[model samples]
Target chain A: MIAITIQQGRLFDPANQLDVITDLHINHGRIIAIGEAPADFTASKVIDAKDMLVIPGLIDLSTRLGEPGLEHFTTIARETKAAVAGGITSLCAMPDTDPVNDTFAVTELIQRRARQAETAYVLPVGALTKGLKGEALSEMVAMHREGCVAFSQANQPVVNTQTLFNAFDYAATHKLLVMMRPIDAYLGKDGVAHRGAISSALGLPDIPSAAETLALARLLLLAEETGVRLHLSQISTARAVEMIHDAQARGLPVTADVAIHNLHLTEFDVADFASFMHVQPPLRSQRDRDALRAGVKAGVISAICSDHTPLMHDDKLLPFPESVPGISGLESLLPLLLALVREHILTLEQAIKAVTHQPASLLGINRGSLQVGAPADIAIVDLETDWLFNRRQLMSAGDNTPFHKWPFTGKVHTTLFQGRVVHQPKLA
Target chain B: MFGYPGLSSPSLQLNEAGKLKHLLTLEGLKPHHIQDILDRADGFINTDTRQIHKQPLLKGKTIVNLFFEASTRTRTTFEIAEKSLGADVINLNVATSATKKGESLLDTIYNLEAMQADMFVVRHAKSGAAHFFAHHVAPHVHVLNAGDGRHAHPTQALLDAYTIRHFKGADFSQLRVAIVGDILHSRVARSQIQVLNLLETEEIRLVGPKTLLPHDASAMGAHCFTDIEAGLKDVDVVITLRMQNERMSSARLPSEQEYFETYGITEERLKLAMPDAIVMHPGPINRGVEIASTVADGPQSVILDQVTFGIAVRMSVMAGIMQT
Candidate 1:
């Protein structure tokens, strides 16, 4: 019975490449009409867009969330809240956890949990190999039939080259997407951040760029040779992006997402020696960040993900050499990225596409674009709202955000998932 | 003085009175005195252009290191440096002693003290344990603190200053050195900061989360900030600290994602510092957490050199104590 209308609102529909003055209509949890509200559509709720742009719910194909091993780090409930805040209606989660998502049971559990959160739709990534060990192929075929949209190893690198090639072949045969973190064990051994001058100064063990670049280089060959689809979970280096760009030109079915943390920050964040800034496939150089950012604009990196690793204080309080690496982005992902769009550094369409259509297409999801007869999954954001990040207001279960006091300019005013209000941010 | 453990109380400042007093923790330490000791150490280290690389400063003295904290690098540096100065050195595995007989703390100290111990190099579990014992015994017994529970490792600080002085040359009067990382529970930081002040270093900044830094550290003459860029701005030397996790028993930290956003030191942030600024950290670094591997392995990052110099630093510390 919550019927609302926006008298005037500018709308940007990327799918149709149209910018029009359209008033969207919603009733009983579905968009009954879009062009105009019916005469019978008496208003219980009404919103005037005021000529601000509106689009379909954003989607991210790759996000680290609902981590099974450490619920305290991030739970389905908190992640869903964060997802809604980020304007993301759908996401594909990584499969590397304590037990892993190699089996269909785990995938089903993830879907159930996301549903319980009642916020966003979660597509689980089934493990490519049993337990991500890469010794034997996982039942990718079976998982696809079981509603697992993609297959990937979240944190673990595909160690065996032949096994990885076989995985690509298997995924292609099944017409399933396989994602992997690009890190070569031999080159990245015991390394954390980008391995070069910074490492000598910080006294940390070194992780060579070859770890990221070589992995992509090898992945390119694997995809070309096997003619299979591959998705780099989080591309953190420039060389990886260039290699991927070349592979795409070569017509290899390869796709990648730059972790939001990777795109937004660089290796410099760790110069302060703050362990919380640490991340896997560690934050790369500024050149790498610039390239990754450019990749998003150039269309080489198709999506951006919040490689959110929710850790209570103890996890990061350890000596730099012993602390865990990862960041939480569910809460700040949209605002931080939107600020970029606001700055005109990136077009809103391109940015939205990175979070939505690009990622949605990667997952084969029907949720990113606003089309006639599509589900009314919507998110209303305050385009010009401004607020400093206090970390206290974020929905993350853990309070360890790196942007504790930084100011942000975009915020989710209201989030509707499957035509239901899941989160309504307090007006600033 | 560079021979560390070479001169018995070089009187680098040569303040009046008593034999060598071990500095384990600076909690109750006269903030002004830590500087004087370092000045004394520096004067000697500066004069010894020893191409001989060998000096008999602490000659004939017997040194024993009792390390509850496992630091082969620190321990080795001391042993090698002390031996070079012609002192007999011994290391004790005290961690197991308590486990076998459940010996109390004092009993062990008394036992060690009776072994005709000329100078004791102690790294213990208690913050001020070394300082406590330094005052407990007669003046003849000399002690040098290697490290103590999240307290102060004075010798470590001396070596850090020694390295900084080596790079910056004598006077640190106006030098800006930022210590980045877990300062709240870092014994190395506590001592390092004290030494930075001792060397008259100005603009000593502590960069990390409010949780990672000691509250009111600014009162201790440090400019505190959560942002690395702001902290790194125009700084001459950047000393990155290892994130201190041993202090946390359970959990309540922000995600690594959040931390990296605000604190990770990438090449971009490095531009904020002077081009020649060096990076320093206590060993066992979480590369990506506190620092990105790119910068940690980068040229400006003096981390490896810090590790390399750690040997010499420790060598000097052992030399000083044995000299007594």
Candidate 2:
């Protein structure tokens, strides 16, 4: 009944106790065992993975694939290919699409497209309002039944406190995880970038660290009061980490994730006003980046996400603050995160877990763990391989990243989505 | 070419994103570049002290203050700083000139360009008139918008922020700043709120008679406060505007005496602020109409200092923009 098999690989399987060295058996698209298998273990084919690192495929809890409505940024084909390039097997897309994902029809359409793309799976988050207009609640129950992963209105916040509290209560009653972007909209109005010495000196648009942290504080309190499961996306500022830490310590229903861009870079990158680095929350200060690293090291932010809203080059390639809100995360997610491992900030295992198992737990997906009975959706990565990133080679329809031509390591050599190689780049 | 220590030569920026670029008004910009111009003017200032001054980095570039708006305070002070910066000076109120041609702005601009104008310091009563010139002129030309038709008076607002930062310190996340009077017609208050919100200043309030303050004031990131005493309550800085006589017929707001009695800044009304809170006015104050003389000339008022900083700040912006 089974077909695929892999041999001789340094396995860092946290879910099983197999550390650094082992073999995995695959049969009928499931991991049959780890360690050297007996002679009777039959397979149609066996590939040697003598010096590779096999980890559970990564999942981005709150990802942005600008498609369906805004296909100019990225279509499903390019985004899924970008996801596989970064070793991400699944991505939970934001609900803030055109016409907004407020109903069952939108969520199902995303899944249907994912199946056709033949790459990463897309779990859609239905909008919490009639049209994400923040006026009234959409049917969380019916959408959840239609395979909506959670009720999410990601980047746009529920401005009125009453409207937000109501969304939380309805989500709690329906046992749905509600994801929030967490910015005090009134304070965030003229703010085009994170406020700091650079922003002060330039006389450019600025948003204080308080704009983000304050809304997080309000959401944490609301979660404590309403008993709703809350997920905070793109925790950018150091102050936000402290607030979320306190929320988690008090056992509030708040789980948070950090964007790779926020953790690895800061406003200094935008000093030349390189439109590529001109992102929303406009890259934090260096001190904030250090704090975020320490936050991840200390486990305050339990997951690492891409916050990957793809914008076409026409939207980017402008002056510093006027460029769009995000960088293409799916393509660079692995290399950038691996840079953290190479920098000694995170162990390779720790790095893999953040993008993989940790986000899996946050998204409540059954994937992202390499257990004996789990589906054999493994990413075979060559940890020591080096490659150059050409913007032209990127699969995402969006070609907007500051690291357009940077050299990178830790490339995914072969990716098995469901025990079949879906993506394979020529080995150097 | 002009030179200042640490600042580069007076470089003309063909691209809107170039450093030291002037963003006086958006007239000649490529539609591809208009939003880029608005995007650059978004930075906040941090000045240390109760009386804010300006950065001295633009010291060598000349900034002529060519204001036709009859005002001694803003004019003389900017002239003072141009001299301080070791730059040549000229203050021409072109109100007597051919500006009334409905003369295309560049005709006036070309006459000045012939005079080796590095920076054309301009002020007109019409909104977007400066932007019109900024766009029509060559990239080598730079314009300073002193005050334009209810469009923007950016430098004034910069000085207000500098003064606020000097007095209130770096955190505006919780401080309440009330900008009262003639909101619909005053570009000074309008620009001030834009800069304040960009700095993420909390509790910014706009107070005026309903006829003076437009319904859209709230979108500008300020609570539209109608009651004077209530709006001024517990505020840190209160900026009052001089009543524009030209708008009297159309304003249809309160009469001068009634306005002073209703929305005017008074010593009694001053009690509603945090003690030691400073008062500001972009003057020729409407002496007894929009504000009582006692508070206009009160102990806490930094009205004159605001004037001094205005010249220095305008020179800084003029020189910096000219350099770009």
- Top candidate by lDDT: 2
* Docking quality class, candidate 1: incorrect
Residue lDDT tens for model 1, A52-114: 556677776666675677785678878777778767777777787667888877777787888
Q: What is the DockQ of candidate 2?
A: 0.04
- Weakest lDDT window of 10 consecutive positions for candidate 2 chain A: A196-205
DockQ, all models: 0.04, 0.04
Worst 10 residues of 1 chain B by lDDT: B1-10
| Stretches of candidate 2 exceeding 4 Å from the true structure | A38-42, B1-324
lDDT, candidate 1, equals 0.69
Query: What tens digits encode model 1's per-residue C-alpha lDDT throughout B1-324?
Result: 011121112332122453234544333334345444444444333333422255667777777787866778778777766776677788986773453222244456667778777777877654444544464444566777777665567666766776777678878987999888777657787667666765668778888876676644643556687778789999988887766454343232466655556777778887899988877666667777777888888887666555445545555555544345
TM-score of chain B of each: 0.80, 0.81
What stretches of model 1 exceed 4 Å from their correct place? A1-7, A38-43, A51-53, A71-74, B1-38, B42-324
lDDT of 2 at B154: 70
Q: If chain B of candidate 1 is superposed on the true chain B, what is its TM-score?
A: 0.80
Q: Rate the local accuracy (lDDT) of all candidates.
A: 0.69, 0.72
lDDT for A10 in candidate 1 is: 64
